[model samples]
Target: MIKKSMLVEKITRRTIGFVLTMLILSIGVFYLSRLAPGDPLQSFYGDAIESMSTEELDAARIRLGLDSPVYVQYVKWISNAFQGDFGLSLKYKMPAMAVITPLIGNTLILGGIAYILVFALATLLALFCAMHEDTLIDRIICKVGTAAYYIPPFWLGVVLVLIFSVNLGLLPSSGAYSVGKSDDILNRIQHMILPLVVMILSHLWYYAYMIRNKLLDEIRKDYVLLAKAKGCTKTEIVLKHCFRNVAPTIVNIMAISIPHVLSGTYIAEAVFNYPGIGALSVQSAKYHDYNLLMLTVLITGVLVIASSIIAQSVNEVIDPRIKLMEESP
Candidate 1:
């Protein structure tokens, strides 16, 4: 009963924290939008703003609620947003959601595939390095992982495109899909390869290095030595003892990485012209479309919070001691 109560309390606190975070983020974005230079009307009228009469400009201001005080406009916007209305995009002249919805799927596809590949390869390589510790293979992988982690993703992406798409003519350089061609799954996969590779290479080394250090620490613990004294093989010790003990730290690292991964995807998508939220965000900024930008920021905030909640929940399941420790004081 006490454990159950503790679990509920932890969940309640996390839920409250999530709500507070969203509120603060929304308010920040709201004010930042107002502070940004440039007339929102320019997105609609361009240089024609100079030709419009005073009455016409005022009418446009009133239409967009820009005529009101900033706080009043913020209140109206927050109220409307709660009801699922995010306003029209100043650039596209469509509802903000209409502009954002289709691009989300493309981002999820690119981000999701890259995330899985990175974690899988990182884990395997970390394990390999951990078991071999200080040997030639371990030293080589550490050097490689360090180099890969430090290389900028965009620069690496450009290099990959030059080599694979331009010089070798092996893959398409830009865009998510071939225009006017059938959108087959294989064709989509082909276009996805370069971005996916970029994402993985950018992240894989850092995670592997992190995991290797974590596993090494775990292997030094008394429990691991006890298992070794009981005749456990090196492989058995790593798999059964070190990995299990390090899992929570790994989960925490992954949780924190979720936002970075999304940001990286944005850059990668823009470079590849992948038509994902990242590319859309770039276009939105170019055209001064704050409604779309605000929505994207809100979505990113939610994702970060959600990832934290997931990591906390997984930690509780894998090591209930964490909950007890928090509850103790």
Candidate 2:
């Protein structure tokens, strides 16, 4: 009963912290959007408005409600955003959601597949390295993973494009799928191959290294030694004992990787012209489209904070030491 009450209290506190972080991040995003130079409306108008007088510009500003005070504008934007409205995109001249939702779908498709693939491969590779620690296989895996880790995704995408698309004609150089092609599973999978490969190559290394190090650390612990002394098989010791003990650390790394996944995909999206959230964000930022840019960032911020909170909570679950420490006082 005491543990249950404590858990509830901890959850409540974490919820409050998450909400506070979200509020601060939202305010920062709001203010930074205001501080950026150039008008979003101007991106819509461009130099085509050179002949327009100040009166015309002011009139246009009023029409867009850009003439309002910053605070009033923010309040209105926030209120509308909460109701599933993010205003019209100056670039697309459509509802912001119309422009963003499809991009988000593309991004999730890419990122979700990449994250799962990279994580699974990294886990296996890291386990292999851990099992063969100090062997030739371990050394080779370490060197290769490290090398791949240092290679940027964009450069890797270019190389893949040259080899697979240009030379062998095995893959398309750009586009999520062939234009006007139906959204068939096979077509989507074919499009995913390049970006997925790029992602796995660019991302798997770090996780491999981290997991390998974690496994090595776990193997050295006194509990692991005791398990070995108790006649546990090698596989049992490694999987049931070591992996379980290191689960929290691995999960923490994954949580940290969430934000990086978003940032990393930007280069991949740009290289392949994948039309994901990363590409949309890049376009929005370049064009100074406040609505889309701010909305994207706001979503990213929420995800980051929420992921962190979740990771912390999960970590506590995997490692009772965290709960004990929290309960200490």
Candidate 3:
């Protein structure tokens, strides 16, 4: 009963922390986006903004609720946000949430696939490297992975586009799906190939290297030596002992890495013109779509913050000592 109460208290504290963090994040994003030198009016009115009189501009700002002080605008936004009104995207002239809602699914599709592939491949690669450790295959993998790690995602994306889309015409160069063929799985996958490949390659080796090092470190631990003394072979020692111990570490790293892989997804979207939230993010930032930008950033923060909380919970399950450590006085 005591432990259960403590767990509830702990969860309550983290809930408060998450709310505070997001509140601060929204404030910062709201103020900084406003301070950035760009006319939100231009996004709304287009080239006509240039031809409007000063009085007309003033009226436009008033109409859009931008004539007030920054703090006042935030108060209004936060209140409206709680009521499910995120305002209009200046560029799209629609509810900001509506503008980005469909795009979120596209991003999830692209990001989810990349997330699974990168970690799965990295784990396999890490295991291979850990088992081989200093053999020719291991050295070759280390050198090649390091090289791939350094290559910029956008550059890699362009090269893939040129080779696959331009030269052989084997894959699409842009969009989440071909026009009006969104339901065709093959067509969607074809479009996703280049961007997804770039996102994977950009991050694959970096994580593989980290996981490889972690596995290697685990193999040197006293427990692994004991296992080996008990007649475990190299393969058995690594697969059974090292990998098991390293699983929690892998989960933790991958959780913290949400933002990193997310940024790569954004870069991929920009380069390939995939119609995801990442692409919308670029557009909103470029065009000063404040309402749209606010929602995008807030959504991203929710993902990152929620993932970290989930990681902690999972860690406590994987190793109860984590819960004990936190609960200790």
On lDDT, the candidate that comes out on top is 3
TM-score of 1: 0.94
* lDDT, residue 141, model 2: 79
Q: Candidates 1 and 2: which is better by TM-score?
A: 1
Rank all candidate structures by their lDDT, best first, as comma-separated numbers: 3, 1, 2
Q: After superposition, how far is residue 125 of candidate 3 from its true place, in Å?
A: 0.6
lDDT per residue (tens digit) for residues 107-225 in model 3: 98899899999999999999999999999999999999899889988889889999999999999999988889989999999998898889888899999999999999988889888
Error of 3 at 328 (Å): 1.0
Model 1 agreement with the true structure over 1-329: per-residue lDDT tens digits: 97798768877888899999998998898887778788889997888999999999999999978899888987888888999999889888999999999888888889888878888899999999999999998998888888888898999999999999999999999877888653678888989999998899889988989999999988888987788889999899999878988889989998899887898899899888888888887777767787888888888888889988899889988998986787677
CA-lDDT, candidates in order: 0.87, 0.84, 0.93
Name the regions of candidate 2 deviating beyond 4 angstroms.
1-8
Clashes of 3: 0
- Residue 275, model 2: Cα distance from true site in angstroms: 1.2
Candidate 1 worst ten-residue window by lDDT: 175-184
Candidate 3: stretches off by over 4 Å: none
Which tens-of-lDDT digit does each residue in 103-217 have in candidate 2?
7778888888888888888888888888889999789878887898899788889999999999999888787888778477788778878988888888888888889899999
Between prediction 2 and prediction 3, which has the larger TM-score? Answer: 3
